[model samples]
Target: MDKFIDLHVHSTASDGTCTPAELVKLAHKTGLLAIALTDHDSVDGIEEALMAADRFQLELIPGTEFSTEYHGKEIHVVGLYIDYKNKALTDQLRQFRDFRDHRNEKMVLRLQEEGFSITYNDLLKTFPDCVLTRAHIARYLSDTKQVSSISEVFDKYIGDGCRCYVDRPKVTPMDAVSLIHQAGGTAFLAHPCLYKMNRRELTAMLDELAGAGLDGIEAVYSCNQGSDEKDFKALAEHYHMIISGGSDFHGTNKPYIKLGTGKGNLKIPYRILENIKTYHQKEK
Candidate 1:
């Protein structure tokens, strides 16, 4: 049997629908040899996932998906095999996390100003202990019948400079690379094609990130359109960087993506992780 793994995944510690233990249980059930819990802006789910993976004897990489800025767009950087317990890692993460809390608060106020019946208190009441990313806000709006759908909420209101959107303080890609490396982990740009960059623009960004000790590229993804995977793989080779892949599963929040086999055609071979381990060893 060929072993497969998901390098990117999410749980309720961020915006995902499933809890940490549930993600591990689901990954084990789906026959995945490993899965990295790269929850957005949070590593809170990793502990429970680690315990669950231990029960199943599966490998769960403690990882995080941090949002960084480039020019004006939001860029996500994924850190894999991180020492999640490292004080330097946790402290910096916590410091930046307060920005998210403030952003959410301001967004709710902006939405209310636009005559939407939302508030920070109501948001917390509905989703206690959940990181209130834009996804959660969109869901709250849709569930309250304020928006026809989650997509509608973004289209009309809070989709990055829409009427109610709020930007966090800038954390550049270089900053992200430094943080991940400080935590003794490998950093990869997640879903590069989705950044809406032309080849020239994308390559330029990759060059900039590479200089900051970026270790790899997420060359395979569930949502990759034609030739995207091939092009990304070529870039990784051209840059002498490692390659990684994942489904970017969010459970019901992103119901179309499946673990291990994403969108019915995605399969990440275990050799990718083997290569990552080899590179990580050499670098250390």
Candidate 2:
């Protein structure tokens, strides 16, 4: 009877299909002791999630997943135990949302050029309040039968290097770590293995990020293989960084990943959250 937690998750506040309240209910039903609503580039859902947490009698951690770039590659930094009301954090994320709106317009235009007959207005009508993302575009394509599947939309049009792809404005990894700290949170590299870098390169990047106040690395992730876990653990130990993990669940948006358990075999012990809290206390 070990308590489990999901440190990374998204709701309709971002690209995820679940609303904050629904996500909280699902976490309780799934028997997770706690869950962090780390929506991409936004904390808009945190307040709603917090209310749901109280109603459901579950622990909720206020967090965000900040998008960043390093050497032109997209990197994600997870900010745990953040002050969601922090003005600096909100302002910065608002700037990013503005950039995202502009980028979405460009993407829609690119798709229209390809004779897709879709418009940004159409996406707005479908997802009125949710943040627009490539996933939304993919969903639009899939729903209209323009693509056979969501994966096809990515593979054929909107994925990185695809014809309709457009890069959003992002901060440097150092700046991202700094922003997390500014919001009174610890920054952890999200899913390092997903970067697909060689061991040496990855080590160097982690070393640099550690120097920039990166507090942890996601050593136990839903998609991680046994070898990946071992490697990430070693890296965390070597860098004297805290270890973290999560399911990265997105509900129906990513149907394969589950809430606390990922792929039906993943189990993240509660000790990880305890360790993170311990580190936060020590930092204070």
RMSD of each: 1.1, 0.9
Q: Per-model C-alpha lDDT, please? A: 0.90, 0.91
Model 2, span 159-226: residue lDDT tens: 99999899887998889899889999989999987888988889888878988989999888988876
TM-scores for candidates 1 onward, in order: 0.97, 0.98
TM-score of 2: 0.98
Residue-wise C-alpha lDDT for candidate 1, range 1-284, written one tens digit per residue: 89899999999989889999999999999999999999987889999999999999999999999889998888999999898988988887887778888999999999989889988888889878877788899889989999889998889888887988888886898898999999889999999878999999998998999999889999999989999999999999999999999999988778888877879999999999899889988876
Name model 1 segments beyond 4 Å from true.
none
RMSD of 2: 0.9
Please report, as a residue range, the 10-residue window in candidate 1 with the lowest summed lDDT: 88-97
